[model samples]
Target: MLLLLCLSVLSQAAKAQETWEVFMEKIPEHLQVSLLIQDEEGQTLFSQSADKRIPSASIIKIPILIALMEKVENREITLDARYSLQATDKVGGAGELQHLPDGSGITFRYLAEEMIRISDNTATNILIRAIEMGYIQDWLKKNGYRDTQLNRLMMDFKAIEEGRQNYTSPREINDILLNLWEGKWLKEDSRAEIMHCLKGCADNSTIPSLLPAGTVVAHKTGTLDYVRGDAGIILGDKPLILSVFVENFESMEEAESAIGKIALKAFRDFGR
Candidate 1:
């Protein structure tokens, strides 16, 4: 406990030493970014706006994946359970499956896999609707997560238009990832399933793209016109949990460059 506490303090001290405006003045223009870097033991090695909430994008799928795995553990639902979808949940971008002939008919487990592997918008919304709200909202609270929720399925036109994008902080969600990496967050069977699902993640442009070839990274990315985010575990002897969210950016080119640049520096600085 003392070690974990110390790590948290040191990580926060880094943030206190550099305020957002001051930090970004050197960073670049037109990007709202929050990042956190931590070691294999769940101790934060570095962070920027680590605990601040921002639009989560597809990162919300992480919690949804956990919830589905938990339900499977409880025998509340089986992986084999068929989860029928409807036209109401469809959203644009990243998922070819959503527009397929048989996309509406898929298993609960498949939906979980599709969301992570393809970053599927429709797949995410389908899983959200499949998992009961009580479980989705309560799971975070039970785990000491102060912020993060998968309220309403993704791309609910009305909801998204109303500015209801799912919100989460890098800190809270990173904690959840740390718990998973440490095998402390969920049941054994569920943990294995969750990892399996994450392994199939399709979007790999962030930290993974910056790392060495063949390095294992279990990460998820979220994107929209106004938001871009990627968060996950980086594998190495000095493994770190890292997440970058850039919102209200001026251009995709700049946001993409900022994510790569910050993560590269963060990984090196913390590991050293």
Candidate 2:
């Protein structure tokens, strides 16, 4: 019986390795891709350039969300607290918040929800200012996120031109998702709140794009002219933590399709 068990495990590992190799062959030669897939227990199922830091785009909002939740848990801030939108707070990006009239009143909870659900640039900026960038940075460092950084606000092109950019790695993001899955950092209520926002993500063109019609993916996506990424927990029989980032892509559709393919393959392979 022991011998059979050992052989079975080895066979499964070999099959998984082969599956990964086949997936790699399908990736375009010109794109820079970093991906990581892990089981619920933090075991790496597959990885490619998982530790390479790439431009975070809006995926940095996950850290911002967590940091804000931490403050809420500690009584440092309350979700009901409201902020009046200033003209300067508006930024052009993927969010309806920007379209709202200036001086509009918004709550911390609504801002948090929109930040993840719509990848709202204006909401993220408001939350960042409320939470304070220094606090979020210290929280990330204290929590052992070495490759993730929140250097500038969203849609800040001048800052980007000056070399200020947010960055995170697949491995680091996977770790964050795994921790959230295991309910590590926040209280149950807080975790559920964050998950609620993630599950309602408005952009379904990446990780959740090719997934089954009703699949539940609590994830976040980031995009730029040359960068695309998605990271989240795929909730199901074999719930997996998956993160995929692609940079230097010529076509946005191609990059998004690559990410969708990777996600669908992982779901089929690991969702057993």
Candidate 3:
């Protein structure tokens, strides 16, 4: 009995070592990586640094979408509410809406879709400015999300890239996605619409590219060089909510590839 117990303990240790090794090796040396996978049935399959605080990049839009949906839920904003493009709202990087002529107008709902699906910088800031930053802050505090916030509009210049205000963690973003998809964010239809929009997200660099093509993942990708992030719901034969945030990568591709490796691991292990 003693010898058998010793062998069992050794096996457990070896398994733990392997788990840590996957994270340590696939995450890249000296990079900050937070990976979390929660079965889509609403159970956490894997979590590490999933909640660890880190820079959000475009992943911040996940919360921004929630805030906007709250406005819709409260009847504070209408789906058809028309918004005109503002020069001040435009931010450089990752989107084309900024360069479109100022006369273009879109509905509040469409803005939310564009912002989350494409990580459209201009659309995100515009919606945030519409809801007012304070509203988003208050919503975060009221909800279960303790570590998510937008330090500024997508491109406040002084705040996100150079300022101390902009940052978030993998766990927070994952929770946001889970709540959004779990039908907890808004009325039934509203929640469905939000998830539907996120499902259409165009940036498929991280989780989307890594998973089986038919697998439905409603996720967004964030990148600011050395830092790359993707957080969303991964629906396979068995669904899961996952967040993979990598910082200090050598390049955008490196960070993205790191995320792909971790996601592939989860898919293999959790789905099997």
My TM-score estimates for the predictions, one after another, are 0.84, 0.97, 0.87
Per-residue lDDT for 137 in model 3? Answer: 83
For candidate 1, write residues 239-258 as lDDT tens digits: 77888888777887778778
Model 3 C-alpha lDDT per residue in residues 1-272, reported as the tens digit of each score: 99999999789757855785676674567777777777766666666776687777887787777778778888988979888887876788777788888878888888888887777888887887788988888888788666786667776666655665656777677677767767776788788777788788888878877777688877887877557888877777777788888876777887777778777777877764
TM for candidate 3 is 0.87
Give the local distance difference test score of model 2. Answer: 0.91
Question: Candidate 3: minimum summed lDDT over ten consecutive residues — where?
Answer: 157-166
- The residue-by-residue lDDT of candidate 2 on 7-51, one tens digit each, is 999899899989889878979989898999999999888999999
Would you list the rank order by lDDT, best first?
2, 3, 1
Per-candidate clashes come to 1, 0, 3
TM-score of 1: 0.84
Candidate with more favorable, higher TM-score: 1 or 2: 2
Please report, in order, the local distance difference test score of every candidate based on alpha carbons: 0.76, 0.91, 0.77
Q: Point to the candidate with the largest lDDT.
A: 2
